[model samples]
Target: MTMKKEYRVKKNTDFQAAFKKGKSFANRQFVVYSLKKPEQKHFRIGLSVSKKLGNAVMRNQIKRYIRQAFLEMENEIQNEYDYIIIARKPVTEMGLQEIKKSLTHVLKLSKVLKA
Candidate 1:
């Protein structure tokens, strides 16, 4: 079977676009920004982990968790949206499934993923 390539929003401008052109919010465990990226026909996602949350290892852990969650759920998601996920301090204590649920919840609330 052919693999599906996941798209990522990597440029700083893409994050800026999500904040400026799209809607955003903060939950108890995460902050989410989402918008439609007309430049893409599929979905793209980005993740953030500030040093304020921890050292390099902690930050990388959070990034990895979010990225995997995004990849796994990207297919079931709606199209044309660019999403940015920022992990809060509490996120370090969460399990992968919890992270996935939070990501899915925010995306759904943003209406980037249709129910």
Candidate 2:
């Protein structure tokens, strides 16, 4: 299943705001930037997978994995934040489970995911 539209950070301005104002955390595979938005009732996420990682197909696959991971972890993540996740080069070599693990690690580091 795909992530719901409301949970996605689609606008460039939203992404820029997160990057400039959020606190960030990183692991080997991903970087997560989180900005608290108390006015928001649910968390929103933005993803970035650089073209340098691979072809369009590969990047799309990585994004799919990330969205699935978040879907699974929805209850564990805080709802009042905007998160921007950037895939690092190493993510090009990972499968869904590995991607989930890496994403979890970064989210935990950012304190957006409950331990």
The segments of candidate 2 whose C-alpha lies over 4 angstroms from its true place after superposition are none
Q: How accurate is candidate 2 locally (lDDT)?
A: 0.92
lDDT of 1 by residue, 1-115 (tens): 2214466778998788888888887778888887876677887778788899889998987877888887787677777777788888889888889988888877777666655
Q: Clashing pairs in model 1? A: none
Task: State the weakest 10-residue window (summed lDDT) of model 1.
Answer: 1-10
Give the alpha carbon lDDT tens digit for every residue of 1-115 in model 2: 7788999999999999998999999988998999999999999999999999999999999999999999989999999999999999999889989988888888877778766
Measured with C-alpha atoms, the lDDT of residue 9 in candidate 2 is: 97
Clashes of each: 0, 0
TM-score of each: 0.85, 0.96
- By TM-score, how accurate is candidate 1? 0.85
Candidate models: Cα lDDT each? 0.78, 0.92
